[model samples]
Target: MDNNKLIEYLETFGALTSKDKLCLIDNVEFKAYKAGDVFLHTGKIANQVGFIIEGVFRYFFYDGQGNEITSYFMSENQFVTNITSFNEYTFSSGTIAAETDCLVLIIDRKGWELFAEQIENWNSIISKITSKTLLEKTNFQRRLINQDAKASYLSLLEQNPSIINRVPQTHIASFLGITKFSLSRIRNQIANK
Candidate 1:
């Protein structure tokens, strides 16, 4: 992972000195995963936060019927974590699985705290990330509640076109809170129109 890119991303939220960037990079560990690998399993306590360097991953939950419901997708340059588990040191309700071969930069909770202490500007960056993530999740849930399957799928496509091509159709259906058949029908209808 290029530490410069990561630092540049952070710079979008606030200015970070080269020394601060180096300090943050020192704590990050690079990891790779196969397409089917599970990065975070449900009910497991996750101590690390991952920054995707390449490929995609899905954060999901299993329903009572043993069906997977994808809550979100993280692509390259994005971050992934079972936030509640990481924050509270409790079991996570969701799992994060690789959708493709992935490379990530991971930092454990301790590393995060150490960096936070060293970088004064990082507090603002962290707050922005937290608020943005919360808003995105809230808006997604609201859309799911108010929109039909087709509308939800269209909205998702409009928002994340790369996901439509990169993620599996079945997973996309789950993410949109629809059955595969429903998704197929929606796709067909969109194609016909």
Candidate 2:
């Protein structure tokens, strides 16, 4: 598995000693998911964390009406895991599915635990990664709360222009808290402008 992307992403949070990097590389497994394949299902424990090498994933949950509501998207270089569920050994409340065919490097709970004992800076590096992930998630949610659907969609485009091409319109609409019709209108309006 070419995990240079994974190593480079980790480097953004903090330095990884040679031993630390080697240990992480040894512990990870390379996995691929076809578009629409579930990475983590609701009601199942998230026993692994994935570092995306290619493609996108959507985090979603069912509403009271049994409609799937997309809450987040994770693309290349992002970590995909239900942080609380992974850390506390609890079932996930949402599902994570590949929005595009994806290649990822995975570290199971056992491998992660081994790193804590074997690697010197494992906890610090992981803490930084976790903090950064949570912060981004919170900020996105906050922005959604403050913005209308069109604004939210536009913001998403500004941040990740390729996402419009990568994810289905339905999923993007759900993520923006709008209907497919509304999204179409928004896109048309933007195009006209």
The residue ranges of model 2 lying beyond 4 angstroms of the native Cα positions read: none
On lDDT, the leading prediction is 2
**To one decimal, what is the Cα RMSD in angstroms of model 1 from the true structure?**
1.4
Cand. 1 TM to true fold: 0.94
Every candidate's lDDT = 0.87, 0.90
Candidate 2 lowest-lDDT run of ten: 7-16
lDDT of 2 at 161: 86
How do the residues 1-193 of candidate 1 rate in per-residue lDDT, one tens digit apiece?
Answer: 4766677777888888878988988889889999989999988999899888888999999889998888899887778888889889999998999999999999888998898899989889978888887898799779878999988888888877877988889999888877899999999999999
Where does candidate 1 stray beyond 4 Å? none
Q: What is candidate 2's lDDT per residue for 4-121, written digit by digit as tens?
A: 8988877777777888888888999999999989999999999999999999999999999999999889998888999889999999999999999999999999998998898877
Against the true structure, what is every candidate's RMSD?
1.4, 1.2
The TM-scores, one per candidate, come to 0.94, 0.95
